[model samples]
Target: MKNYSILSVTCLIFASLLLVLGCKDDTSGQQNAAGQQLAMSLPVVEIPTKTLTAYVTYPASIEGVVNSEVRAKVAGYITDVLVDEGQKVNRGETLFKLETQSLNQDAAAAAANVNAAEVEVEKLKPLVDKNIISEVQLETAKAQLQQAKSSYNSIVANIDYANIKSPVDGYVGDVRLRKGTLVSPTNQTPLTMVSDISQVYAYFSMNEKDYLNFIQNAEGATISQKIEKMPKVNLLLPNDSLFEEQGTIETINSQVDPNTGSISFRAKFDNPSRLLTNGNSGKIQVPKTFEDAVVVPKESTFERQGTTYVYKLDRENMATAASIVITQEIDNLYVVASGLKKGDRIVAKGVSQLRGATEIQPQEIPFDSIAQPIQKVFR
Candidate 1:
């Protein structure tokens, strides 16, 4: 009986030892798995600020100052097209030619008649002076000479119209006609279009309130002075890339567009190389006026229902979604003129997963190259 009791006790001790060992192994495995799941690194970024020039962007289109479509005035078969598409042409330069054989013959005939009448008038003048011819005869001869001279001039003008010429110096657009194509005088089908692209114009619109404010402020200001100190204009290309150069406001529309509730405005830019052609659409940023402002990265803000919100890091590194009031600046960035103060740590990125009073590990990200430049402006 004692041996049986001892055996049972030994068995209980062995089972306890086995259970303890299994627990230790399981705990160590859990620790290893957790260590492996940890993030390899935390994100860090550089933040700096400087004074930045601000711009207000709007949609705009480019147009040449001088644009025209060259047309044929006289009807005839197109004998030759002197200028090719995209070729540069100058004023009075022949662009195309029409066969003017019939017109040329008429001119020649008129010239002969004028010469014969003039000769008869000269002979009759002497005869009238000598009283060898009556005064009425001399008068009749002079009238005939005058009429012939008028006819000659008319035919000469018609012959000149046979050659098509460019009225301005510019690049030719499309050559719609070819040699031997019949063209009509009334139908002035363009040979091509020409434009003086040495300077380009940009047209844009402003809201009625903005337009009113501008005029009231610029009432006594000179256009040149206004342009020099006037709001800075930034031009963006079709690719959404901004032009390195800036432009100046040239003119404001005489009246507001009733249909659109906006006032139109124009800007001028020197395009010496003719780089900006007609019909290019892009965005223009115009800095109207200044105000005491605070700005933030647009990505950090969220919109819910009708309000805009941002996530801010508290002392405990907890993200709290806070409501903010903002005004749009250049690009997609926003100016948080209110609802944020200096030195507040706002989540500049990755705020979508966060909620109010949520505990989170904060990671800093580098300012994008585009965003980096704007930081300097704030300082």
Candidate 2:
């Protein structure tokens, strides 16, 4: 009876051990299946062709098309500042008035001298006609009278010059001199400046390599023709906002600047509202268009060891890393130069979680939907 009881206990212990091992194996299989399901579902998109424009920006300086300096023509103290800074004025309008007290006194003396000389000439002419005095003496008196008159006229002209006037019809710049400040013609600094803001010029520069490339890509035999054929460019203000008016590239420097090794370019913009002024700083955005280019969203790309890549989806929805050469990056899209083409499917997001040849259940999405809020620069 004892031997039979020992045999029954041993069988029962073995049976319990087998049941626990079988339960563990089933749990492991279920976990593996869950992980595979999670990896299979990811968003993918088919590449599309687009007309993309990329901007190459350079630092630009703004200036009025006509910047005229206001200077005093005669030495004097300013009595009145007729125009305030930023005030709009017309041509020949008085900007400032210099004190004419000393000039008036000098003019009085010159006038007296002219009168005395005229009286003497008249007396001498009568004597010469009567032959009572030598002709040489009369001629000398007439010459002295003419010199006195010229001196009087010069003093009168100087008094008129004391009223400084605007040379151009434009807005006034800073008031470098105020009331009672002494100014002269030979002063190194100008009294003030008048800028014609009806039109403004934005000056920018490009290096030799870029200039050559720009010229070669333009469709013209001459520089002027190239400018005529080139598309209009946009201006970026210092605050990073686009200017309301578009600008046209009007002039290019004939020769490259040896010191800077860059060529200068001038673009003109209409400033009807006078928003742009002299000495304003901004950027010039020169656009280069890529027609019917294959582009991908930046989110779908990753960089590895300085090489850009995207996870391409094969026919079987398997993810494989493919290299791409980027020609230009605009806003949130990359213009693919090589290694990718239109209609190719790429993992839209979650590319980091994928591995080589990993099969996925691609949930296809529209390309534009993923590349939202793209800058519309093509016009």
Best by lDDT: 2
Q: Which residue runs of candidate 1 sit more than 4 Å off their true CA positions?
A: 1-50, 209-228, 288-292, 296-305, 308-322, 329-334, 343-379
> For every model shown, what is its TM-score relative to the native structure?
0.72, 0.88
lDDT digits (tens) for residues 1-379 of candidate 1: 9999999999999999999999999999999999777322222223233244466678999988888987777788999888787788899999888899999899889999999999999888888888897999989988999999999998888778888888898888878789999887667566678988778899999898877666666635665565456665788998868776678887777787889989888988888766788888889887644354466667677899988987766787666788888655545456665777756766776667665576666676654532543334443
Best by TM-score: 2
What's the residue-level lDDT of 225 in candidate 1?
60
lDDT of 2 by residue, 1-379 (tens): 9999999999999999999999999999999988766557889999999997889999999999999999999999999999899999999999999999999999999999999998999888878999999999988988998999999999999999999999999999999789999999999999889999999999999999999999999999988899999889899998889999989999999998989999999999999988899999999999999999999999999999999999998888789999999988888899999989999999999988987778888998999888875667985
Where is model 2 more than 4 Å wrong at Cα?
1-23, 31-39, 374-379
TM-score of 1: 0.72
lDDT of 1 at 164: 85
**Candidate 2's error at 139, in angstroms?**
2.8
